[model samples]
Target: MKSPGIVIVGAGQSAAVAAHALREHGYRGHIAMLGREWHKPYERPPLSKAVLVAAQEPLLDVLAEEAWARSNIELLNGSDVAALDLAQQEVRLANGQTIEYEKCLVATGGEARTLLCCPPYRRRVHYIRTLDDARRLRAALQRRPQVAILGGGFLGLEIAHAALAVGASVTVLERATSLLDRFLPPEVSAWLQSNLCRAGARVLLGTSVSDAFPVETGRMLLATDAGARLEVDEVVVAIGLSPNDALARNAGLEIGPGGGVLVDANCRTSNEHVFACGDCASQQRPGQSQPTRLESWQNANEQARTAAAAMLGASPPKPPVPWFWTDQGAHNIQMLGLPADDLEYVRRGDPTNAKALWIGHRRLVPIHAVAINAGSELRALRPLFDRDQPVQLQDFHLDTLNLRAWAKQQALADAAVPR
Candidate 1:
């Protein structure tokens, strides 16, 4: 019989990071990772970008074979976990096999939200969620067909950009007034829309596909809510993501408000032996009222470290400010902190040239920031957002102000204060 140690369900970014963190935390025991995917753990960000445009297969593997072998971590790929037997502290697989574990981390992640109006039809419709999904879409895009993206969110814009790069006619349909309206400042959203339009792709705002049907031999017809018809070769859906928490819920783990395994500060689920992280875990942070499932690469990595520490009974690291980024068409937009609608926006540089940083402040306290092709400057600004004290606008009022020096000074000042 194999010795039981830490068993992580779902081999994605969160699972891979948790396994590596365990070894980093000086854990030398039996570690098994079961995943439904055929390939080893890979990153998801490339699925919408490089995977679609490149002819060569992108290196998306998070952990190499040698790393797993060196750590003696058993990876059970293509194994579908049917249920979590909480009573027995075992993971029951679909093939009638059970793996007992001292502790289990559920990082099942999420699935792409599909549209009811445009279901998959003979490969005419595609959704970029898994590796297989990206491969299929990549092959389809190679034909240089007209591509219609269903959403104007990060993924949709990214797919549109990729399609355009491959000589495919692209059109992005968004139901909102602007791209990423809820998250970005109005001016920034406008700039994103303008950039996409300049890249030889059509961006339709306040429009939604009401119906989709086959039009030609290898094409699809999409009807818009605004009474317009668009004939396209492929339809890509990027609406949102739905958490895969059925295993946790069926096993009697308390789920959060928006359909994720409810976890506390330490990423512990309702059952003490089981924990959840990544997109599958919903958490109510220190100041938030409602638990939110953050679907970002940074969140997944940080939460995985936290879950790993908690499993070892070690002190978990403090959560940092929420950050997300997207790359599309000569622009790299990075956002820091949570979204708030009432904050005032102050710009430090010109956004038209794609070198600017916008700070959202409330009562002279920086809450959020958006960096347009200024990632390094954005990193320097983190000290302000991480700090609890209010900052004077004069510190960064000048466009030529050295934010790096300002950040270093603030760090020194913070360290000088007695805890």
Candidate 2:
């Protein structure tokens, strides 16, 4: 019997992983990937960090050109999927090309939400979602220009760090009272703010831009709502993201409240043959029925793997513990497992030194440690976050709770038989 042809839309991490996994599972069908960007599928995490520092490193391409060709996956770059005909199981591209597929994966990721308070920058402003955006932003930074970031979220802070690294003066304008208000608590956010300021970047909280207009010498005059004015060379917007669910909605597929395509645990959409993953799909948790969407790289990669397996009628692999990490200035913060708002928080280490663990539900749920070069330490504590056997706060000896010892204890405990 002939295998089924698989078409994956969106050439980000998720779509690329799905295409590779389908071929790896011995599927001898035609595999095609559609990407709107001119470049091949690549990782987004490095765009804000390493790529900002070095543009010629090819940070965006997640898969090598030679490897993709060897896998027999036809990559259609700079092609947009205009419409989806669910009834016919076909996708129409902007170039007037139609591809029939036995299975389709929609991984069209979200776009950065620009600030609406001021008029458009007209080629003067930039957003760092695509490789092109990063290239332009990097060029601006190379000029040793002054940068005014519009938001205090992760993206904004990451960009701020990169600009400062190149000796560029940065001023971050945040409407919120603190940075990273959505993810970190007040204390944690405050700690992050202090670190950014210490790194020579000025952070303005509870302030928003009233108007931004081009001025002399490639500079912009920003009128603040707080009766202040800022003159900067360029502006970078990192407010948030809005999902690209228009394609699914146009096809009459069910969408969630926050503009995400609704999908089941198996990553299947309302139409069984069409699947969605990454930042585009809104999926329910393992036990909870409430719809949720995660924009982290971990979620995107894991969901892609699951969607590919399900399409091939293979047993899905167990989902890894959801985790995310951020690199800002000289600190490396890693968050393992989920931290709920209602859950009680207990600080296990010193915040000033950038080494601490947050305990939730009286258990070692999320560990966020920061240091100059603590990548190894952060990776070590990841496996200790076992949902099945929750580690209580008392089980952690703050002084001696290194990564290796913690992992050994958790392994022994998990290995023991239960009554």
Model 1 spans > 4 angstroms off = 1-3, 395-397, 410-419
Residues 301-334 of candidate 1: C-alpha lDDT, one tens digit per residue = 9999999999999999998998999997768989
The candidate that achieves the highest TM-score relative to the unseen native structure: 1
Provide the global lDDT of candidate 2 against the true structure.
Answer: 0.79
Model 2, 26-56: lDDT tens per residue? 8888888889998778899988888887646
> Please, what is the TM-score per model?
0.95, 0.90
Q: After superposing candidate 2 on the true structure, give the runs of residues whose Cα lies further than 4 Å from its correct spot.
A: 1-4, 55-59, 117-121, 216-218, 287-289, 362-384, 388-390, 395-397, 402-419
How much RMSD separates candidate 1 from the native structure? 2.5
Pairs in steric clash, model 1: none
RMSD of each: 2.5, 3.4
Listed per model in order, the count of residue pairs whose N, CA or C atoms clash below 3 Å is 0, 2
lDDT of each: 0.88, 0.79
For model 1, what is the error of residue 152's alpha carbon versus the real structure, in angstroms, after optimal superposition? 0.5
Candidate 2 lowest-lDDT run of ten: 364-373
